[model samples]
Target: MAGSDSLFGFGKGPPALLLFLAGMLISNIGRSAYFVCVTWIALTWSNSARLVTILLFTSTLAQFLTSGVSGYFADMVDRRRLSVSLDVVRALVVALTGCAIAAKIGIWVLFLSVALYSVVDRGYLTAMQSMIPALSRRRSAIAANSASYLVMQAGTFLGALLAGYLLHTLPYGIGLFPIAIIFATSAVTLSAARTELSDPTHANSIYSKPRFQLRFMYHLGRHRLIAPTLIYSLGFGVGFLFSSLLAAYVLDEMKGGAVLFGQMESAWAFGAVLACLLLISGAGKLLADFGLAPLLFLSGTGLILLWMIPGPITAATLLVALGVIYNASRILMDARVQQTVGITEIGRTKGAINTAATGTGLLAFTFIAVAGDTLAPSDIFAQYGLLVIAVAAGFLLPALRGRPRSHDEDRSA
Candidate 1:
C-alpha cells in the first residue's frame, strides 16, 4: 500500500493521500479543542458532577440523533462532496460559536452551539468513515483506518495540549476563538483534497439521487454481527464516557482546582497518544486476532481499578493503563468489523455503531446526572464500576461461546 494504487484505486499519486491525511489532522485538532473547551466550560459554570455529566452526555446525544441520517446520506450520495461540505459546515458552526461566546451570548445559545457543533462534526466524521474504504484497496482498509486513527489521535493530543497551555496563560474562554480558526483551516484543507472518482464511470458532481428510507437503519440493526457488535460497542461507549469525567471528579474530590485538573487532563491526552502509537505498531491487530472480548472486558476493569486508586501517582498510572486498553479494543474491533463487513455496508454498519455508542453514552450520562446529585463521589464510581462489570460480562460470555469464527476466517483466509 505504498504507491498511487495504494493511495487510490485509480493510480492517482500520493498528493491526494497527503492532503487527506492533513485534512484529518486538522479536523481532529478542532474536535480535540472542542472537547477540552466544552469540558472546561462545564467545570467553570457548574461544579455539580451531575451537571457535567449531563452536558457531556447531551453532546453525544445530539450526535446519536444525527449519525443515522448522516450515514445514510454518506452512503447514498456523493461521499467526497458531502464530506467536504460537512467540514465547511462544521467550520461555520464553530466560528459562530466562538463569536457568540465572545459577545457574551445567553447560556442557552452556547448550549445550542455546542449541540449543533457535535452534530456537524460527527456528520463529517461519518462521511470520512465511508470514504476510507472507497479510497483504498480491500487489504488496505485496515491500514488506512490505522493511519487515520493515528493521525486523528495525534491531532487531538496536540490540540488538547495547545488549548490547555492557552487556558493557563490567557484568560478564560480565549481558546474558543483560536479553535475556530483551526476548524476553518480544516475545512479548507479537506475541500482542497481532490476526490478522484472511485468508479471511472460515475460522474464527479455533488447532486445525486437522494435515497432515504427507514430500512437502512432497520436493516443495519438486523445484521447478525453488526447488531451484537453494536451492543458491545454501546457498553464500551458507556465506560469511556464515564471515565472521561475523571477530570471533574478529581477537581471535586482530589483537592485539585482548575490548574491541577488541567494537568491531569494533559496526562490523559498523552496517554491517548501513547495508546494510539501502540496500536499503530500492531498491538491492535494482535488483540483483534487474539482476544477482543477479554481485551475489552479488561479495558472496563482497568477503568474501575483506576477509580479505586487512592493516590495521584497510582491513579494516573491506572488511568494511562485504562487508556491503553480502551483505545486498543476500539481500534482493533473497529478494524476487524470493517474488514469483515466489507465496503458495501460500511456506512450503514458504521452509522449503527455510532448511533448505539452515542445513545448508550446519553443514557449513562443521564444516570450519572441523577446519581451525581444524590451519591457521594466514591459511591458514584463504585456503582458505575458495577455497571461496567455487568456489561463486560455480557461481551465476555458471548466471546467465549460465539466467537467471530465466520468473520475471522473470512478475514484470515
Candidate 2:
C-alpha cells in the first residue's frame, strides 16, 4: 500500500513525499507532546494563568519576528537542507531543556528554549509550505495539503495521548527525552528525501538581490483576493486561543486532571483529522465553489455554539465541529493562497499571512494575560467566539459583492 502510486495523489509515490510526510509526522508528534508537557509544567510551577499566557506570548512573538525573514529564505535557500538543519537544532534544544529539567533548573530556561525553538520552527514551516508546490504535480496541490494535514492531525492525536500517559506515570524529565529523540529521528528521516531545490520554475533567479523590499508588499496588496484573505487569516489565531486555554479549562472548570486534559486535546485532534479526511475525499470542491466567507461564517457559528453551552461534553462536541470548520477553512485558504501566488513569492506571501496571524495571537495573549485574573475561561471563550463572528460578518459583505475569481483571474491580479 505504501508503494502504491495512487496513494496520496502522487503518481509514483515519490520518496521525497514519503520522507517529507514521515518527518512531518514524527516532528509534529514531538512538538505536540512537548507543548502539552510545557503548558502543564508552567501551570504547575506558577499556578498563575498569566504566566501560561506569557509563555504562549513568547513563542508567538518569536514566530512573528522570524516569519518574514524565514519566508524570504524559503524562496532563496535550499529548503530541504534548511528543514533538516532546523529539526536537528530543535532536537538539541529539546535535549538541553531535558537536561535543565533534570538539574532542577528554573522555569525561565524552558521559556527561553521555547522562544528559540519557535524561531527555528517558523523557518522550517515556511520552507515546508514553499516546497509543497515543487514536491507534487500541480494538479495535486490540494490533495497533498490534505494528506499533510492528515499526518499532522494524526501526530497531534497520538502525541497528546502519549504525553498525557507519560506525564501521569513517569517523571517530568523522562517525558522530555521522547521529544528530543523524536526530533532527532525526524532529522534523519528528512535526510532520505530526494528534493530538487534548483527547479528553475520555483527558484528565485535573482537570489543575490535584497528580498526585504516594499515592492513585495505592493505586489501582494495589488491582488484583491490575497490582501483580504491574509487579513482574514487572523481569525485562525482567535480560533486557536482554545488550545492555549484548554489546560486551564480542564483543571479549573472541568475539575479534571492531566489525563482529562490530554483526552480533550486528543479529541480536538480527532476533529481535525475528520476535517482533513473530508478535504481529501472531495469536500474541497465546496470550498472552491463557495469561496471562504461561507466557511468562515460556519466556523464562527460553531464557536458561538461552543460558547452558548458550557460543559466538558458540550465543549468537546462543539470542538469537533469547530475543528472541522476551522481546519477545513484554514487548509482551503492556504491552498488557495499557494495556488494564487507565483512560485517566487509563495514563501514571502505565506510568511506575511503567518506574521499577521501570529501578531493577532500576540494581541489575544496580551488580552488573556491581563483579563484572566478577573474573567472566567467561559467568558473569554464566548468573547472570542463573538470576535470570530464579527470578523466573519465583516468579510461577508465583500465576498458577496465580489464574484469568486478563477485561477486565471487570481494569477492575473
Candidate 3:
C-alpha cells in the first residue's frame, strides 16, 4: 500500500497525472503523424535524401536557437500555463500547416512550419520536465518519469503505424487533419489539469544578473556525478541521428517502401515502451545497480551491431535491442540528474544539458547531411557508433579509477 498511489507513485491518483499523460500521448501522436507525412512529402517531391536531411536540420536549428530561452522562461513562468500555451501554439501551427498544404504551398512553407513547431515543442518539453518535481514526491519522481516516457513511446509507435496506414490509403492533405485535431485535444487536456506554482526564493535576484545563468551552467558541469552523467547523455544524440537517417536507410539500402519504414519505427518505439514499463515496475533499480557506464557501453555496442546486420528481420531485431539499452541508460541518467539537482534549478540545469546535447546533435546532423551526398547511411551510422563507443570508454576510465587517499593517512603510517 505504501507505493500504491495510482499505480505509478503519483500521490493519491491526482487528476494532474492523468491529464499530463493524456497530453503527452496525444501530442506525441500528432508529432509522429506529422513527421511521417512531412518526410514522405519531402522525399516524394525531391526524390533525394539530402532534402530530407535539410528538413530535419531546420528542426535542429530551431531547437538550438530556442532551448536556452525556453529553459529560462520555464523556470520564471508558471509551468502549467506555459505547457498549455505551447500546446495551443502547436495546434495553431499544425492547423496552418494543413491549410498551406491544402492550398498547394511550396516546400519552404513546410520547412518553416516544422521549424516553428520545434521551437514551441522544445519549450513545452522543458516545462513538462520542470513540472514533475512539483507534482510528485522525491521518492516517486522516477516512477513519474517512467510513466510519462512510456506514454510517449506508445504514442510514437501507434502514431507511426497510423500515419503509414492512412498515408498509403488517403491523400496527403487529409492526413494532416487528424494531427491538428490531436494537437488541439492535447491542449484541452493539459489546460484542464491543476498545478501549484510556488515562487522561487531567489528568482528575482538571481535572474536579474544575466551573468549568473552562465555561472550556474559552469557550476553544474563541475559537479562530479552530474558532469559524467551529462557526458554520457551526449550519446543520446546519436540515437536521434540514427532516426533521421532511418527512412533513407530503409529505402536506399534495404530497398523497402513506406510500410516497411513505418514498421521499423514502430518496432523501435515498442522496444522503448517495454523498457519504460520495466523501469516503472522497478526493474530499473536492478539495471542501475550495475552502473551507468556498463549500460552505456553495451548500448553503443548494440548500435554498432545494427550496421553489421543485412536482412530486415535482423536489423529490426537489433533496433529493438538498441532501443532498450539506449532508453534504459537515458532514464537512469535522467533520474540521477533529478535526484542531484535542486527543484528550483531543475529547469535551468536540464535546459543547459539539453542545449549542449542538441547543439552537438545539430553539428552531427549537419556533418551527416553533407556527407549524405556521397557516403551511404550505413557508413555514417557506423562512424556514429564508433564515436559513441569511444566516448563511453573515455568516461568509463575515470569512473573506474579509484579515489585517491589523503596525504595525512600515508604520513601517519
C-alpha TM-score for every candidate: 0.85, 0.90, 0.90
Worst 10 residues of 1 by lDDT: 199-208
For residues 238-283, write the lDDT of model 2, one tens digit per residue: 4557757878878887888899889888888888899889888987
Kindly provide the TM-score of model 1 when superposed on the true structure, using C-alpha atoms. 0.85
lDDT for every model?
Answer: 0.63, 0.75, 0.73
TM for candidate 3 is 0.90
- The model with the greatest lDDT is 2
Q: How many backbone clashes does candidate 2 have?
A: 0
* Candidate 2 backbone collisions, by pair: none
Collision pairs in model 3 = none
**Model 1 C-alpha lDDT per residue in residues 1-413, reported as the tens digit of each score:** 35555642213356666767788898888787677766776666666666667667767788878877776676666766776777777777766776776677755655687688888887788777676765656554445566677777778767767667766776545667677778778768766765553222142223222343334455344444553455356446634454446656677567776565655655655565676676556565565565555555565566566557656777667656665665555556566556666455566667777777777777777777766757655555555556667765665564568765444222321
Show model 1 residue runs off by greater than 4 Å: 1-12, 197-213, 221-223, 227-231, 238-244, 342-344, 376-378, 395-413
Candidate scoring better on lDDT of 1 and 2: 2
Q: RMSD of each candidate?
A: 4.2, 3.3, 4.5
